[model samples]
Target: MTFRAKQSVRRFILGTAALACACAGTLSAAAAPANLAYDKPAPTINPKLTALSKAMQPKVYKVSNRVYVAVGYGDANSTMVIGDDGLIIIDTTESLTSGRAVEAEFRKISKLPVKGIIYTHHHMDHLGGAAAFVQPQDAMSGKVTVISQADTMKLLASSETAKANPLFTRDIMTARFAYMFGAYLPKGPEGVVNNGTGPAMVAGPVGLVPPNKLVDDTLDVTIAGVRLHIVRTPGETDDAISVWMPDLKMLATGDLLMGETFPNLYTLRGAEIRNPITWYRSIDRVRAFPAEYLVLSHGRPALGRDKVASVLTNHRDAIQYVHDQAVRLMNKGYGPDELAAAISQLPPHLRDDPYLAQFYGSVSSSVRQLYASYFGWFEGDPTTLNLLPPKDRAQRNLALMGGEAHVVAEAQKALAARDYRWVADMLTDVIRVNPSNMNARKLKAQALRQLGYAEVNANARNWYLTSAQELEGAPLQIQNDWFRGVASPQARVAQFNAMPGRAIIGLFAPRLQAERTLDVHKTLAFVLSDSGDQAGIEIRRGIAEVYTQAPPSPDFTVSTTKAALARLAAGDTTLAHLIESNAATVQGDRQGAETFMSYFDPPLKDWSDLHFTTR
Candidate 1:
């Protein structure tokens, strides 16, 4: 069978399995009573809205008397708002197929047109259905108004880099399926929830329609006669926004307020460290609202003023608890590792709150993030300040641990003792020393699974499970159907030029041996046709690479639109294919062409064999 045919079959099977599991009472109901084993008390329900899906799916509910929120397997949450003129949506679930299934719920409510869309954040589960909402032009046109924070635009625009991270957003997509979706949350077997059910799917290169109106602090607008109070919050992303309706006393807190789980201070996908202080403050800002009902971008809604206040209070306190503890240690001059160990214990109040659980994010990782954000990677020790390369450090550590076997054995002991953090560390060394260590891989997977199951933070759980999945085998590939015909060629060139010089250096590192050094002094520029945004980058070593707007004749002139670049970055096609197809062109130095290819460091090709532990 063709790849597409096989994928279709896989998706069908997975969807069928999910439907069966959801119908079998394996998934918990979103509005189950608090006293019930799986049901948490419904937070204050918005008086303006009534819950639908009473006959369709027990876990699915609706608001605005038009919008439908479906709680699916993996704790996956989707929202459909039917506006007076049309429908305005928030999140789109994990896949187009799943998103359509969500849309069907909306159909059951009302068949209003989908007029506008808002991506709470950039996570795939939330924003994967751009194509499903409307045609590409419709999304880009002012009629649809695909709104998001400016930072979210930056993230979506740099889709290539986001996908390139070691822990790609694909992992986030699947992990959400296993952990948050209804299959495991209310009550299910401890480790039976698996995220790897569907074929690989990547969102199309999204046409980043910046919010026509940018709100630094807050912005109030009415959609379909319903007033939405949008507020900026730096939680999962530096540019995160939450929507509220004072009239309804309802708040749609994008990723900021998951039903039960601590937020991920340190995400697995590599990025700048997030500030716990800022996260707490953002939650505090939301709590100031007279919100009676709370709906998270993920998980179920909280109904009632008291319940909403309670969840918000716990969420704020949980973040503050971590921040306060980390700050206390930092004041004592404790390093990242020290702070991580020191703040492992949570105060009983914070620990007992279901909202503060570590289902996604962990205390240890958050502590490390606090240190990294405040003091960077440098520790006080000079020897550690300027560290050896990763591979060298792994080799040295392996030798010190009496070679690979001994290191693996120690890792196993750590795993048995439930020392997952330590097991992860030891396995890192073993994997570095010997990348193909199957035993190390298995141990790493086990450690990650333990971490995933224990996490209260949804993002953290996803990260751990994703890591474990990578260890076991290649993750299913996400089809890049979304980007196929939507990218702009000029935008691709601009994006390539705008990539951070440090990232470019890292990408090229594999091909750049220590013995060979090239000092190419030159500046390059590219002007995007679509947005008319011009970006110029200077190439220099040691000195910081500068970005500007005055166009310069680059050493090599490569011409390709942003759409083509998106396809290349998404692994839809190769750089060579673009050149051969006349979609992309390069001029100037032939040697420069070769040099550029050297810099494109392919990410770890195998996702499944990423062993988590040394043992």
Candidate 2:
């Protein structure tokens, strides 16, 4: 038989087996008495889960008659639904190793086949291990239906932004690794036992296949005679969605209804700002369901109808409160910073609720995102309207502070006072001014660690600690090859052209002096190429306008891929080899090419002083 045919058969068998197992296991676990108020106030504290479980415990809990939910203690959690016919899964965890662990838990209870998979959103942590649950064949075939919102397919397809922007993604990954697995997830509050068990080793390729079924607004699917409702709501991501089971009275709130941490309205890794108003509205939509149990994508499941309702209500109120308060302050002409400081505390009732705590994101950041969304980044101060470049500003600040030593002293004072935020700000100036100051680097590292330790939000903690670790000498290796495999030259060219004029202009720094600037008097186009998927990009320059086009060759062509251009842009490597090796073929005038290269300013290695300030 052909490979395709064989694969199809394998998938059918797997799907059939999964279904049989789920059906056979349904009778193993007897249903617990309903409405029997178990005096046990929900096992809220598990020493192994304390640090990361503030949102929800890690233990498995019965959400409905047959459906069960197990919150992953590391990375994003996964929710499982089992019925007489088969099983449905939401969010697949970060790695296959962990995926196996999650599957094992389900198997221990039932031998059922997983009939369908639902993605909450397109984040890797939520859908990375789909292959483990449903087998490739089943996914390829129509045996198992994978579902997500209409926009989710776009997000999943373009999710390689993490791989494309390596520098930013690496920094975010470092932070994620440290917080989600290092000491936070396992240690809890008592203390940590460093058995050296790091994050589950994730090997093999990392790509999530698009769901087979797409839902724009709402979708109803009957599996094993169980009705499942999927609804879309804009929250952490534009394509986010939530799942509801009317028959089971269980609601699977992807990342929207995460335990205690505030949503990341503005991710530091670089994404569009999330709408706080819409986020609150989405939470309210989930509350509208007759959900007797709430199972979140990342934390423990909240059991009991009354308890679930109360939690969802409060979750909605918490976000709405922040949104409304921020709007009120904005109306009163309070700036972002002022508004953030004004509402430093949550409502009295929510302040201590484990679900409302800040373990992954903070209200301060959310306030800034809201302000930016409504008013843009400018604060209306003329002095700050057109600020000098960061390095230049650092240099000026250093001179005014009486040199590096003086700035270092101030940073030290801030550190002594435990004002890590100020220390980070002050030390950043010192590093920029005197890049070789070892003392400044050490102080900055310490400040970052303290900031990380104090952060209740996991992402914030990871960012701070990762920054500290990087300063302490983590290798700054850029993975150029990773981008080559996923990035499409044609798509990138389209994106480049589609970018706003201002965004394109932002790419050019005035300080970077090229040999000569080619005045683009008219629009010009160029061709793109790929070096074994390792490099691809369009080379374009003109007097009036310059842009890139996919596939077809332009009037003039520069043969190279986006990866090579990115490497050249970041100053990670030189392009002399490509030119000399004939790897880069140019159709345009050599002078124009030279001018284009010259315009890009060389990256500065010594932008910061370890002891005092930035230069």
Candidate 3:
């Protein structure tokens, strides 16, 4: 039952090699030189998307003598402050590979040993690439102190990235995210234009360095002779905080205000409902600071107090206006979908302001979220109280509206008439009932392509186009992902140490294949040699639960170091291998426990390049 490691994942839409060949023909202007088309059909031909792509290019902006902001490098930005002694790097980009590049860039500016690192929030974009800036050994030896809000890790454990059902969550978010960031599209005239926040998604590793110093509310710390007042500003996430430099007249606002775009009150990517009211207040709190220079986690820095204040105030008011109006409409009996349409168009005064652009976040999406937050899913309508599931509803609707072919025929008519929206809606039913309906699938793809071309928000455009490609055939999607390599034993141990015993067990429960565990009724005691910590995992029928205290007379006892256990859990080593290699020892019913351990699915359960929709 032990897992044999598979070859590396090879899912790539325009794999790095192919991209170089395609673009190398012409380095500048357009990807395609003359009228000689690129080998593949243009990913998109949207002029707006194409035009905007240039502005999103990554560049390091030098704010002043001490400050520099690296923008559009990856999904996020890395801000560097060269202090009197060593440098203080704030908010590392999403990946270690990217972070390493940013660090190299810093070396060019100043060969300053990193004295400290500050995490503004719990998002991966902010803190995932910590090791690139400073080594774990250095952090342990007290050479560098990683700093963040006290609740940073806790908030991360509950965030969208750390969801209990990650694959399903990705299904809900990936397609949408692709559009928003032009992920699936090639970088050229007719393809991916610009990611609203920045430019590209680069391949890299995810590394996390736990904060040695945690900030609660506000903390005054002088690192490398720079007096920074760390202030709490929980906007995007609960653990959000901002750095105020009294000497430099600068404020590092992490995702709080990402330059030119409407603040995302709620992302289409499923997350705990964000309170816009709290978001606005957080912005207001920052506005109270006499910041002459404003450096954000994403986009260019704003110099001068007047410019900084205007950007902050306008961004805040735009959010307030949208939230207040959405609530007002909800009070007058408006549902989320209805409110989305009703409250989307901002006032001319607000809309004309460039920062409030619907490039990244949209007014409609925010309004929808606002309505949902106040008045749950039910709109006081009994008809919607207990509805059949989508597939069931699709079956019922299909029966009433002829059959799959008939639905496809109608969709064809709609497509011919250029009723793309209607075609999209009607063909969805046809596809749902019969995913093999090539006619319907192609027609729907056509309709979706049109919709994707028309979308302004990066997410919607990417989602539509991604779906269109999926309908075309088996699209290039990751299956059995090999990009995210396993973490080192030391890193794994650090992560495991942070979680409570029960939560750690709950993490593994999702991967337990019920059928495989049906007859494996046993209580196993896991004794960690390194930490001297122990937990009892009781398997009842197909369900598994964990207890802090060890169960007396346990059926099996698995003795292993925390690091070895972490490896076993990660599928780097199996129970059989562990026992053979003497990395782990099982004292009771070794054979039975080995069988039971095999039943637990691999680390990435159901990992694949998913065709998101059921159809």
Query: Quick one: best TM-score, which candidate?
Result: 3
User: On residues 484-571, what C-alpha lDDT tens digit does candidate 2 reach at each position?
Assistant: 2112232232232222222222233432332343433211232334322211123333222223223344334456654445444445
Backbone N/Cα/C clashes per model: 54, 52, 6
Better of 1 and 3 by lDDT: 3
Candidate closer to the true structure by lDDT (higher is better), 1 or 2 = 2
**Root-mean-square deviation of every model:** 10.1, 9.9, 7.4
Give per-residue lDDT, candidate 1, residue 543: 29
Check candidate 3 and list the clashing pairs.
Answer: 44-190, 179-458, 179-462, 180-458, 180-459, 478-609
Q: Judge candidate 3 at residue 358 and give its lDDT.
A: 76
Residue-level lDDT tens digits of model 1 in 1-615: 233322322332233223222221121222221111222112211111111111112246655454467654222466666666887777665444455555665666777777767777755556654455565467546666666765554454344325344323433333233333222222222322212211112222222223434555677777776677888987777667888877777788888865456676775544455677788789898989998778876556777889889989888887888888888889888998888778875688778765655555668888888788888888778997678988898888778879999988989899989899889877887887776888898898888778766553434544565556557654533212222111223222333333432232233333333233345555544333433434544455422243445346666654666445444543455656777898767666645654544443343333323333322
Lowest summed lDDT across 10 adjacent residues in model 3 is found at 1-10
Candidate 1 lDDT at 65 equals: 58
Q: Which candidate is the best by lDDT?
A: 3
lDDT of candidate 1 at residue 361, scale 0 to 100: 64
RMSD of 3: 7.4
Runs in model 2 lying further than 4 Å from the true structure:
1-50, 53-58, 159-209, 386-428, 470-615
